[model samples]
Target chain A: MKIAIDLNGGDRAPEEILKGCLEFLKNHPREKLILCTTKNEPDNLFDLNHPQITVEYFTHAVGMKETPAKSKKEKPDNTIEGTLRLVKNRKADCAFSCGNSGAIILNSVDVLGLKDPNTHPSLISFIPLYNRPPLAVFDVGALGNYVFNAELYFAVLHETVDIYTKLYGVKEPEIKLLNIGTESWKGTAEHKNIYRMMSDSLYNFTGNIEGDELLFTDASVIVTDGLTGNIVLKLLESFNVLLQNFRNFKDCKFDNNYLNFLIEDFNYETIGGAPLTGVNGKVVIGHGKSSSKAVRSALELCVKYAEI
Target chain B: MKIAIDLNGGDRAPEEILKGCLEFLKNHPREKLILCTTKNEPDNLFDLNHPQITVEYFTHAVGMKETPAKSKKEKPDNTIEGTLRLVKNRKADCAFSCGNSGAIILNSVDVLGLKDPNTHPSLISFIPLYNRPPLAVFDVGALGNYVFNAELYFAVLHETVDIYTKLYGVKEPEIKLLNIGTESWKGTAEHKNIYRMMSDSLYNFTGNIEGDELLFTDASVIVTDGLTGNIVLKLLESFNVLLQNFRNFKDCKFDNNYLNFLIEDFNYETIGGAPLTGVNGKVVIGHGKSSSKAVRSALELCVKYAEI
Candidate 1:
């Protein structure tokens, strides 16, 4: 199996990306990697002589501030577009990017194509819970403000969860609609309609769930629009960072280990990156500031998803 | 100043509510309390004979599960309605309820009326930040699923912030639109339009702010539709509860005091209740499961708002 990596994607690109590629190579010796970089010559940190890895050079790199649609159209040789091409042409099994989430998503949809052209892909992230299986939150920010049909989004989410359940060996994954309240009458008309649709379907529809339910509930999959999902994802991310800063308090009486453990649940690095599911090909997008370990985890996630 | 307290509201009604009334009476000797209850006789927990307090009995109580609008229409004697009636009839300066937030909002709007009937009320909650001033998040549950005008919402938020700044002696409270992203191009067309409108207005508009920015940003008042605000508020509340459960880990090495301090920041009980702003009369709504301390804080909040 082969996986394509975008070296020009993340904030700490080239060096961290190269190191992560090495880590992936060390862990999965037989799995082939196609690394795409904007640099003509690879970074000195990476031993390109590794037999399992091949490097592809791209002339252009998309900046974080660049509009995804415009960048995709204007820069054909951009690392994100180039990486997606590899997956599209069957040169690689899957693609990974830690760059601009928006750019990666747009370029992936444009190059790799969507499973259903009528529907947009959703960004799905796995959040680890204390005692239960990790919950998957979708549309973390792929569609943005674009009005989407609730039924289509749910259909894509259902199909994505089916693949995830089979791949992870999760038995009877419960699907839930994310809303402000769990009551039947609560939420927008669209949300209520979607809830009813899911309930009538064959999926293990567990009814409506709230944002707080994400951490403690037994539901395996939660669905929402990109706007709400993005806010929820980022809020949790920021809260985690705030908690980590608490460790800096030298005079505090809290146990360091317990504090670390508490913050650990929210650490996104442990989960690596989010997958752009409902697309035709396997695509994973990491945080812009992902560490080398996180990049490696993103690559590993692609491999796991590729197996499905 | 006279503040009305609902006795038959909240999960722990009558007892907790009565205790809170007594606490308020003890703390604010100059403030008179008008206690509304469904019971003919007080719970005996309260010193009803106190010169600062008076009890008014009602025949009906609204359950948390009952529909808010339907309940307001059917049960005119409910504690929420009865409490609001005191303010409407000029018997009480303000009112507090730890019952159903929806019920409080609807009954308050129905009984006391809005400052402007065209402008819907927003549920404004004060979230205590670590180093910075507390952040006020609005539309926590009010105006649910309604297609509200952005201009009206912003107007109400701006007016509310102006009052808050003057009342709390806040110097130049910055107002921001709560969104999925900080970029100008982010969020729905309505959000972007609101951003532009606020920018042109006299209010200190800081453009669109992501959910993560809530914790560390200098923006004093964040505005969003009820659905998003409710989800965000509940998400934080649930996270706090989850963190509290972590205290059960006796073997962990974290400092208990520091851990407690971190958890305390997200504690809803500390803030008492959310004020239903944009209404003609002052109405503060507390969490349904509020303890006596929280209930007391809610009553104190009503007094403070009444002073404004």
Candidate 2:
């Protein structure tokens, strides 16, 4: 399967993203990749001799300050758009990006379209917490005006569990709904309804989990609407940063390198390429803050998800 | 002001709870307390001697395994209910328990009668997170049903801030609505409407806060429904415990001395409590598996909140 790579959109844009895409190609020879960039000469950056990789230059990018809608509408010739167009034209199996997540999602929907009425792109984040492996938290801030229908939630959770299990090699991933309580019936009307559906569904369904439970519960997949999922996911991220700060203060450190040793090596690409589940076309969105590591991980995860 | 104390609640129960009550009396002579238990009696098992602390034995104890509903209904004559009745009858300003939280809420609703419609007994938990001062998280398993009403949320946040500022001695507590993202128009219909109300209202309202911003942002009160609050709070508790476990591994022993160092010396309430907020009267709830220190902290926080 071939993946179209967006060479512009993230903080570092073409430079770091191109380097990471090249590195991913070095590791996975069986995989084919197309690098679409705004760089004056994409071929000048790499050897350009490798058959597994190809390059195209689009000459424009969406800046971080612009609103997502404005960027997508204004920057038609942007590398991120060109990359998604490849996926739309079926020249690439799925598109890989390290661009603005909002812009990526906007373009993803504009080009490939949402998989279904409810299939907006979501940020799927995982935290390596406690004895449990990574807990997948979906919607790291995709849906704004959100009311989850139980069926779409089911699909997202299913995809989250599937992709997470494949990545961690965990047996029987425990899928827990992101909730306000431990009982089966808790949370808003949508969450409560999902709880009811999950109760009789095939998913592991650990019932309603609290805000604090996100860090400790053993569930591999914590499913919620993009609205709540983003808050909790971001909360876990802040908790992690706070814990590191506390440890640094406790030990009197100038830097948190020692504490960082205990945490999982975060790869931007892995969480960056959020699979727009239920879409007819294969597509994924990456963060605008993506570094080289994130680009590489997104490529791998998107490739794996596309295979399914 | 006087408070009724459940001297029989933790592992040490009457022993430590009574001892702490005595210490409070010694330092705060103006503040009086009523200590009750199945038995605060000591036949070489415990010591109890405080001139100002009144001890009364109800002669029946509710074990942790017993459901709060069943225990309150069956053991209506028990110390838990009888001690709370002191508040109902205005014999004491409020009641404090280091026992089961469920029991306290059930008994409080029955005895003191909660603060009318739209507000039931909700647990207001303090989360010392981010760079900001500690914020209040409510409804940590206080109820199962959740309505996406912003006004009710404001009421909880408003009252909690009122109590928190008075207790912590802050000038004005800032409040923020917890959501998946930090957008002017993010969140569901109810939250969007509530956000509008909060911004319009007199309270120092910060616009939408994302989960990632939770740590670095400067907001004292983060409001959510009970179930989500419970998950986040419990998950944080477990992480704190896990960090302790890691520290224990590093220490190579259960450093009781160091544990107490964090408890007594540092003034950090090593034990946590869930106070039923918005109730007609003050009642503190402790973990069912509360140790001696936990019981002490719960009692102290209860007294502090009552005074505020």
The estimated TM-scores of all candidates read 0.93, 0.80
How far off is model 2, as Cα RMSD? 5.1
Across A1-308, the per-residue lDDT of candidate 2 in tens digits comes to: 89988776677877888777877887898999988876664456766678898887785777754567777667778877888888888899988776666677777778887666764455577665534456677655565556667766665666666666776788677777776546554566777777788778855765766565565566777777666666555555554554443343343332334334344342233355566555556767676567777788778777776686
Candidate 1's C-alpha runs over 4 A off are: A40-47, A146-148, A249-260, B40-47, B143-148, B245-260
- Model 2: how far residue A306 lies from native, Å: 4.1
lDDT string for model 2 (B1-308, tens) is: 77887766655576666656655566566777887776535644334455556666786776644567778768877778867888888877768776665667778888887586666466777765422346676545554455556667666666777777876676677777777556766667877887887888755877777666765667777776454555556655654554553443442333344433322332224435666766787777766555555655666676777777
**lDDT tens string, model 1, B1-308?**
99888888888987888887777788788999888877755456555588998888888888877778788778878778888999999989888888877888888778878888667788888876665556888777644354436777876876678667865678778888888667777777777777788888845777888877777788788887677787788788777876775556555435555456666666777778888877888888888788888887777778878888
List model 1's recovered fraction of native interface contacts, to 2 decimals: 0.50
Chain A accuracy as TM-score for every candidate? 0.90, 0.79
For model 2, the docking class works out as: acceptable
